[model samples]
Target: MMDGGRGQVNVALEVLADLNINIPVCGMVKDDKHKTRGLIYDNIEVPIKSGSQCMHLVTRIQDEVHRFAITYHRTLRDKRTLYSILEEIPKIGEKRRRELLKKFGSIENIKNATYEELLATPAMDGKAAQSIIEYFKQTSEA
Candidate 1:
């Protein structure tokens, strides 16, 4: 995922959602165990329970998405230096913010995006998208 980042993960989620792919996404989320954990999407997290019957289901899914987005069984090891001005915003973090930038292409374009447009990106809820739009407008005026 985009240089082993969550933003790329969210992008994958959106692409799947748009394509109407109905599988749950599971991946290595760095928490206490340092083991394979569930991914976060749309502000909610779908976790993978280990050593359970659900584990098999989760593993099957993780394997499938991996084959689709990536080559074989490996994760994205490196990332290119692709970014926009919006990604520089504070409190945005690497996941949701970069997703917004990539989806909108630029701050100007994102400012042009309606609330529904902003919400199209994964993890961007109504409030966050509106706040981002407001920031874009404020910065444009200043």
Candidate 2:
């Protein structure tokens, strides 16, 4: 499943083809006011009624897909910010950064974690844990 108008659908199809993916793709398109108006399948328009069982299902799917995509994007953005912050602390490379995120879930959680908890994370040692704690402290103080 995909979202957007004709251009986006075309791009998605091209990208998928490059990746060797072959599957039916359908797009949920929105009108100018950002209302889901119809489904575009294989370049054919399936008009959706304003209020009907089929429309209800399409709306639900569109809403859920949009929410999921936004949440995923936000998570990636947070991870990038966290990774940049972690890079400032010595000895915290990609592996350590991933371990920290996996353990604490977020940068805020990592900042609030106890020294012992930080040390308990995979690939984390006492020095690395102390560096992370001190980094957050210095940032907070500034």
Candidate 3:
């Protein structure tokens, strides 16, 4: 969820940059303990300093993205779910899925992660890592 949050912040920032949504943009940051801090504005992070600003921007973004998600983004995540890492080979069943999740933790970690790190997991192999790369490519296309 934190990774997703970071991505959302980045997307909002990019939208502001590209479309010139000049509302003062801030990022909701999490501390090392994984606690919700405040926000970062213009590279200077202020913990919960601009929660209202961040909330307003996020709400606006959700409204806009919800409007467009089905039309554009769905086409991508939908197409790729079939070829996704854990779902790629039929041989990888429920047990393997649980094991993978237990080992790697989350999808974002598995995605940004290197093949070597993946292979280092107990019982995970090169073939699984390759499948992960294939899934990553699909998601990136989205």
lDDT of each: 0.64, 0.88, 0.64
Per residue, candidate 2 scores C-alpha lDDT tens digits across 88-120 of 988798999999989888888989999999999
* Clashes (N, CA, C under 3 Å) per candidate: 0, 0, 2
Better of 1 and 2 by lDDT: 2
What is candidate 3's lDDT per residue for 1-142, written digit by digit as tens?
1123455667777877898676755555766875445556666655544357755665566567667867787767853563365675434655656666677676667678787987776667788767767777787899
Which candidate achieves the best TM-score against the true structure? Answer: 2
User: What tens-digit string does per-residue lDDT give for candidate 1 at 1-142?
Assistant: 2222366667777889999997655334546655556655554556767777765765676678767777632333322223445555544557886787678765567778898988889878777877777777788799
| RMSD values, in order shown | 17.5, 3.6, 17.0
**Model 2 Cα shift for residue 65 (angstroms):** 1.2
Query: What is the TM-score (0 to 1) of candidate 1?
Result: 0.36
lDDT for residue 105 in candidate 2, whole number 0-100? 84
Error of 3 at 137 (Å): 1.4
Question: After superposition, which runs of candidate 2 have C-alpha atoms over 4 Å from their true positions?
Answer: 14-21, 103-130, 133-142
